[model samples]
Target: MKGNKGLIFLSLMPWLCMEADAAQHWADTSAGVRWSSSFREPYNPEKVSKTILNVTHVSQDDYGRNFLFMDYYISGMEDPSKDNATGAEEFYGLYRRTLSYNALAKDPIDSSWVKDVHLSGRMDVGYENTQLSPRPFKVRMGGLVDFKIPKGSLEWGLEGVYQKSYNGITHRHFEFDPSFVTWMSWNYPVTKKSQFSGILEYLEAIGEDGFGNDTKPLTIFRANYIYDIGQPKGFKVGVGYEQFNNKYSSNNAADPTNGSDQKTFVLLGSYHF
Candidate 1:
């Protein structure tokens, strides 16, 4: 994992250096960090928990009449279950790149019935070593289309992703054919510093094979209400609810369930600089 991360950094060196010149033409860059915790009830009898520390950087530039944007996320997770025996937990790393363009650059943002369209392609690679497996690697390729209609404060997007995996342990063979995902979201402001947003998405694995047979499609729905905590500093807080439905192929001795449903309540705090 370390070696692969090093290689990925080296490959992006040229582009990183070009940022200095690119800034002069047209570009914006920002970095932020986030921490999140997830909980499961039945499957995690002891309240099994994990922590994720993430850092994200994004850049956008304009070349002639086209637009370009790039985003990067680095995350590390700490698994409490794996720290029992060896007193050591595993860390995962991921690298992703995206290139995109705008389809309606000539239209004015305030024009009536005007629309903005964007098309993007992305690649992601990740590595994780868990208690059950020595080393696991996954690769995914995907494309997305985004549409923005400012007149109604609406945004929609569609995405298709294909993933392949290679397992390093014998009994833990894993494979996934392909998956398709689509989501639509809308934003509405109710007060001077408060807003509401809702999103619905469907994700499914296309076929059954190897470990893929054990995984099934998922439907997720989420709603959030956000309020500004500080007016001058740009700090905000959000409360949300999410629901999920997932199914597995066969039941194991430890866990035997064809399908399960869960609902989660989340609280988030963020500061923008």
Candidate 2:
């Protein structure tokens, strides 16, 4: 079903990134793999292991910048995928376009703290091969305030979007609602060989879910301190702390222990090219 679509998109990502690199002023792409065994299953209280393969691309053109990332998740057999009847696999991706006010303005504002402002458009798409076989799609429109930092930068942004979701169990009968999201991201150099970076995002819940359960707000937070290994940008490794409360906006009424909350440490590695 949706997994087929996700597979096609993920397979073509490399080619798309290469084309964008040739057409953009500046472009960079990174491939990273991460794994964790501390994740919990929703509704059912049990620990499961998950591995993720992530590919990210960022490019700047005459107008502004483009950013995209795709994640492929493989879970243990305890949560088997519908397609394979074994481990579950999910694909999720996000694409963002930032139209810079400074780049288009006649006279750009040069304030001390505010580096630039941007009107941003974002799209999120995801598909999972679990029993539910959820397909979620959303489009966001918002603005971002970019601030300058010593040898680095930070971005604070907000988005308002409508979510349209379909699942195998509920089909298309579930209620769709609009949600507001706020996020912050920053990266700073701790030393020449080390850097601190992370992202914090909060999503306001919409209406009821597929099961008619009242959806809850979602919070995702990740902070990492990465150290460069060999060359300047060749190989890197880091450890990070991650937290997810009310993940996927699912309110675990069946499991009163809040089995959905995930606060764990993750090991990360990446290569930039």
* Candidate maximizing TM-score: 2
- Residue-level lDDT of model 2, residues 134-245, one tens digit each, is 8887777788999976677699999886676777875663535878999999999899998999999999988888877788888999999898997755888999888888
* Model 1 lDDT tens row, 1-273: 467557545754544444344434333222222223443322333322333333333345441112232222222332322334332233444443333334225643443443444443334544444444333343333434344454335645566655444544345544455577766766778687888888887766446534444565666787888788777236777787766665221222334431245466766555544
TM-score of each: 0.60, 0.88
Give the lDDT of residue 32 in candidate 2: 92
Off by over 4 Å in 1: 1-38, 41-52, 56-60, 63-80, 83-114, 124-129, 133-153, 166-174, 209-214, 247-260
The reply for model 2, stretches above 4 Å from the true place, is 1-23, 173-175, 252-254
Candidate 2 TM-score versus the reference: 0.88
lDDT of each: 0.47, 0.81
Among the numbered candidates, top lDDT falls to 2
Candidate 1, residue 179: lDDT:
71
